[model samples]
Target: MRLLRDLTNITFLELDVTSTKSIASAYRTVENQTGGKLHYLVNNSGAGFVMPLLDSDIEMGQHLFDVNVWGVVRVTQTFAPLLVRAKGTIVNNISTASCMGLPYQGMYCGSKAATRLMSETLALEMKPLGVAVVIVITGNIRTRYQGGSYFSSIAERIGVYARGEQGHPQMEANLYATKVVGDVLGGAEGTIWRGAQSTIVKFALAMIPTWLMNQLAVKGTGLDVMEI
Candidate 1:
C-alpha cells in the first residue's frame, strides 16, 4: 500500500468514517491543508462483517451500516457544498456484493447496496447544481482489511466453520485480497483500469430490469434467489 501511495498522487488521511465529528474535522483539516479548494472527493472508506444472518450480532450490523452506509452519507453531505462550489465530482466506492448478494457478508452488502442507491439519487439531485456524483462499484481488492487471519478469527467466533471442500469463505476472501493488493502494488494505472471496468459493469447492471438483475445476482453469488 505504501509503495502504491509513493507511486501515485493519492494522499492518505486518517478519519473515523463512522463519526460525523471526525469526518467534519478531517474535512476541515484537508481544506485547510489544501487551501479550501477541493476538486474531487472520493468516499472509499469502509469495513465489513461476515456471519450467518441468524447468528450475526445486531450491534455488528449497526457498526457495518455506520461505516458503510451512513458514513458515506455523512461525508458526502459534509463535502457536497464544497464539491458543488468547485463543480467537482463525488465518487462513492461501492462493492460488487451490493448487487451480487453474498452469503455471510449480508450486513456489509446490504449497507453497500443502500449507499449505491443513495449515490444514484444524489447524482440526480446534484446534477441540476452541476455536481457530479459517481458510484464506483469495486470488486475485491487486496488490503490489510482483507487479511485472512482477521476473517478466520471472525468465522471461528461466529461458529460458521467449514470443513473439507465445503469452501471456507475466509480463505476465499484472503486470496481475493492478495490478488487485489498485488494489482495495486503492480501499478496505479492497472488498478484504475480495473476500477473503471467495475464501474461500467455496475452501470450496465443498474440498467437491467429488477427481476433480471436479481436473477443475475443470484447466479453471480451462488445464492438462492428466493432466499434473499
Candidate 2:
C-alpha cells in the first residue's frame, strides 16, 4: 500500500499459486492490464517445513511439494503463453538446499531440488519460443519464516526426545543435528551475516566432492541414521 501511494503504474493481484483457477484469473488480470504483454514473470512462492522424514506424514509431505514445487509449475504453465507473446523471461527462486539435501528438512529440500530441475528443463524447452528461463538459487537469508507453520510442533517433538534422556541413538543424533543446523542458520531470526555466510556455504558445498557433501549433510542434519 505504501509503495502504491507513490507509484501509479504498479498493480497488485491477489494470487493463490497452488490453484490453477486462481493462477488463470491472475493471468487474465495481468493480460488485461498490460494488454497481454509481460516482460518478466517471477515464481517465488514457497513453503518451509522442519521435521524428520519419519515424522512427516504423506499429507504433510504433499503439502510441501504442492506449494514449493507444483505451484511453480502451475504458475509458469499459466503464464507461459503471455511470456511467449512478449518473448519475455521467467525467473524461478530456488534454494541452495536444492543443490544438496539436508536432514530434518528433507521434504523441503527435495521439493526445491525438483523445482530446480524442472526450471532447468523449462529453460531448454522454452528457448525455441524466445522465452528465457532464469533461476536464482538463494542461500539462507534473514526472515521470520522459521517460526511459522509447523516449526513449533517439530521443535517440541525434537525437544521431547532431547530432554527425555532416552537411550535412542537416532533421536540423540537428530537433536545434535538440529542444534548444528540451527546454529548455522543463526537460530529462528537470522543475523545480518546470514546471507553472506549462506552464500559462502553454498560455494563450499559446490566445490567439494559429492560424497564429502553427503557426509557433511548426514552429520549436520542427522540423516546418517535415516533409512531411505
Candidate 3:
C-alpha cells in the first residue's frame, strides 16, 4: 500500500474484477494519465476462499472465478496495447496452488489452475509480439488477502469438521498461515523474480500426467485417504 502512495507517476485505479465497464474505465484512466503509453504491467490482483469442494458455497466459488480468472483476462486485455507498444513484460502473479491441490482449498486451487492455463497460452500468443510474458508461480505470502476474519466466521458457520475430525481443520489453517509467513520471509516479492530452481520444479511437475500429479500432490501434502 505504501509503495503505491510513494510512487510519483503511478496511478491506482479501483475497479471490480467482475465488471467489464470497471475494467475499461481503469484502462481509460491509465491511458489518459500516461498519454496512451505504458510499461511493465503486473497482474497481481486475485481472490480466493478456503472451503471443501462439496460444501463450498456457489456464490463464493463464482466470486473466486470472477477475480482470479476473468480479472486477469480483463486487465491483460485492457493493458496489452501499452505493453505491445513498449515491448515490455507482463508478469502474472500465479500460485503454487495451481499445481498442488490442497484439502479444503479446492475453490482457490481450481481458479488458479484456470489462471495457469491462461498464462501459458498467453505467453505463447504474446511471443510473436516481442512482449515477454512471465507467470510467477508463488508458494504463499503473509497477506491479509487470505480472508483473515472472514475465514474464521465461515468455518464457524459451516461447523468445521471434515469426516468427523475437528483438529484437521485447525491444523490446515495453521499450516497455511505458517507457509504464508515462511514464503514472505523467503523473499516472494509479489512475483517469482528470483529462485529460478523452484520455477523449474513447478514446470516439471506441471508436465507430469494428471494421475501421477495427483498422487504426488496427495503424498506431498500428506493428505492420504486415511488422513482426509
Candidate 4:
C-alpha cells in the first residue's frame, strides 16, 4: 500500500492468473491504460509444496503448475499481441530449483522447470517478431508466498525422521541459503544466471551429475527415511 502511494507511475491491477476471466479483464485495463501498447509483460505467479512426491497430493502439484506454469503461458499468450505492438519484452520469473531438482521441493521444481522450458521456446518463437522474451530464474529471496502449509507439513514430516541430530549434515544448515538474481537479458538475447553463489552452485550442480544430486537431496531433506 505504501509503495503504491509512493510510486506515482506504478499502477496496481487485480489479476488472478489462474482465472482466464480475471486475466482478460486485467488485459483490457492495461490496454486501455497504455493505449494498446505495453513495454514489458512480467509473469510471476507461483505456488509450491514441500513434501515428498509420494506423500504430496497430486491435486497440490496440479495447483502449483496451474499458477506457476500455465499461468505464465496464459498471461503471455494473452498479452503477446500488445507486446509485439510495442516491440516489448516478456519476462518469466523462474527458480534455480528448476535447474537443480531438490527433494521435498520436486513439485515446485517441476512446475518451474516447465515454465523455464516454455520461456526458452517462446524466446525463440518471438525473436523474429521483435518481441524479446526473458526469463528471471531466481534463488531464495524471502517472500510471504514462502510461508503456509508447505512449510509446516515439510517440517513435521522431516521431524519424524530428523529426530535426535541424526539427520543429514545438510539439514543442519538452511536448505536454500544461496540468493541469486539468476537469468536476466541484456540485449534481448541470451540468458544470464547471476546473483550470490549462483556461478559456484551452477557449476557444482552441473558437474556433480543428476544421480548424485538426487542422493544429496534425499539425504539433505531426510527423505531417505521415508517408507513407501
Candidate 5:
C-alpha cells in the first residue's frame, strides 16, 4: 500500500474486505472522490491454505472463506450503487484453482469457485442494471504469498525466483491484471483465462476426465509423495 501511495496519480483508499463497515466506509470515500460515480470495482482480495481435508481446522478455515468469498460480495454490494450509476464493470481476480480440485487445496479452490459462479450470476443480474461483470481465471505465476497449512516445503519456494520469463516475480501477474481492466473498458465480458498456464489448465480440464484429472492434480501438487 505504501508503494501505491508513492505513486503520483493513483488515489488509494484503505479498507478491510472482511469488515462490512470498512467496505462501506471505503465506498463512501470512493463515492466522495468520484462524486457518486464509479467506473470499476475490482474484487481482488483473497486468502488460501493447503491441508488435508480430514485434518483441517474447520473453524480456522472459516477465515479463508470470509476473506476470499464474502469479501468480494461485501465490497461489490457496498459499492454497487456507484457502479450502477456509472454503468461500470466489475472485475474479479479468480484462480485456475477454481477450475481444478487439487489435493490439499479444497477450501481455497472452493472459495474461488464460489466467487467465479457468483460473478457469473452477477453478470446476468447486473446486465439489466447496465453494469458489466468480468472474472479473470488466473493461473500461477509468481508472488510473495508463502502459503501455510503445514506445507512449508512448498510455501518456502514461493517468490524465491521467477520460474519463467525475464522479469520480477509479480511482473507478469500484475501486467495481466492491468490488461484485464483495460479490456473491460474496451467491452470485454464473462470469464477470461489469463496468467501463466491458465489456458493450458482450462483446456486440460475440459478434455480430461475427472478421475484422471484428480490423479494428475494430486501429482502436480506433490501430494503423491506427501505424507498424511
Candidate 6:
C-alpha cells in the first residue's frame, strides 16, 4: 500500500472482497471516479491456510472459499458492468496449486482450482461483450502471501512429510506483475502462466503418469510411510 501511495494517480480504496457492502461501496466509488467506466479490474484478494486435511475444519474450508473463490466472483460480478462499458480487461490471479493437490494445503488448492474454472467460464462470458478475462496461473512468490499462508512459519511444521521433491521456485512477484499488465495491454487473454517455473511445473504435472505422480506425491510429501 505504501508503494501505491507513492504513485500520484493511484486512488486507494479499502475493499473487502468477501463483503457485499464493501464491494458495493467500492463499486460506487470507482464508478463515480471513473465516470461509470472501469477498464481494468484485478481479482487478487487471497487467503491461505496451511494444514493437513485431518487438521482442517469445515469452517476453515469455507473461509478459504469465501476469500479465494467467492471473493473473485463477487468482485467480478459487481464490476462487470463497468468493465463492459469500457470494453475492459479483468485479471484473476490464481496459483499453481490450482492444478495440484499439495500436501497440507487442501482447501487452498481446492479454492484455487475452483477459481481457475470460474475464470475460464468468465472469460467466455466476457469475450462476447469485448471484456477480456485473463487468468494468471502463478507459482510461488515471496511476499505477504507466504506470511498469509503461514507457508514458512506454520506449514513448515505441518508440511514436514510433504516436502519431497520441492515445489515452486520461490520468486519475486514484481517480475510477473509488470509482465501481466503489459500482456493485458497487448491484448493477451485466457491463461498466462507466471511466477518461477510455473509453466514447467504445470507441464510436469500434466505429463507425469498418474502412478508415478502418485509415487512422487507420496514420497515427496512423506506419505509413503503409510504405503501398505
TM-score of 4: 0.79
Best by lDDT: 6
What TM-score would each prediction reach against the true structure?
0.65, 0.72, 0.68, 0.79, 0.85, 0.88
In order, the Cα lDDT scores of the candidates are 0.65, 0.69, 0.67, 0.70, 0.78, 0.82
lDDT of 3 by residue, 97-190 (tens): 7776766779888999999898889988987897777677765343444443334434542333222233322224345445444554453333
Candidate 2 per-residue C-alpha lDDT over 101-191 given as tens digits, one digit per residue, 9 for 90 to 100: 7656788889998998998899889889988776666654433445443344345544443343223222232343344344433322111
Measured with C-alpha atoms, the lDDT of residue 197 in candidate 4 is: 45
Residue 220 in model 1: lDDT: 29
Comparing 1 and 5 by TM-score, which wins? 5
Of 2 and 4, the candidate ranking higher by TM-score: 4
Q: Comparing candidate 3 with candidate 6, which one achieves the higher lDDT?
A: 6
Question: Least accurate stretch of 10 residues (summed lDDT) in model 2?
Answer: 187-196
lDDT of 1 by residue, 1-228 (tens): 456576566667678878787888888877887667667777878887766676678998998898888888888888876777777777677777777565567787799889888887888898888776666556644345543333343444333312222232232445644544454344321112133235555666668776776565445233442222
lDDT of 5 by residue, 25-48 (tens): 888888888999998888888887
Cα deviation at 163, candidate 6, in Å, is: 12
Ranking of models by TM-score: 6, 5, 4, 2, 3, 1
Residue-by-residue lDDT tens digits, candidate 6, 1-228:
787788889888989988999999999999999999999998988988867676678898998899999999999999989999999999999998898787778888999999999999999988999999999998767676553432434455455434422553676768777877888888889999888878787888879986776566556454544322
Candidate 5 local distance difference test against the native:
0.78
Write the residue-wise lDDT of candidate 4 on 1-228 in tens digits: 454578778888889999999999999999999999988787867886766666678988898899999999889989988999999888777777788777667788899888889889999999898988777656544334433443453466655432423232231112332211122323544444543345555787769987877786567453565432
Better structure of 3 and 4 per TM-score: 4
**What value of lDDT does candidate 3 attain over all alpha carbons?**
0.67
Q: What is the C-alpha RMSD of each candidate to the true structure, in Å?
A: 8.1, 10.8, 8.1, 6.1, 4.3, 4.5
Off by over 4 Å in 6: 147-168, 226-228
lDDT of 5 at 77: 87
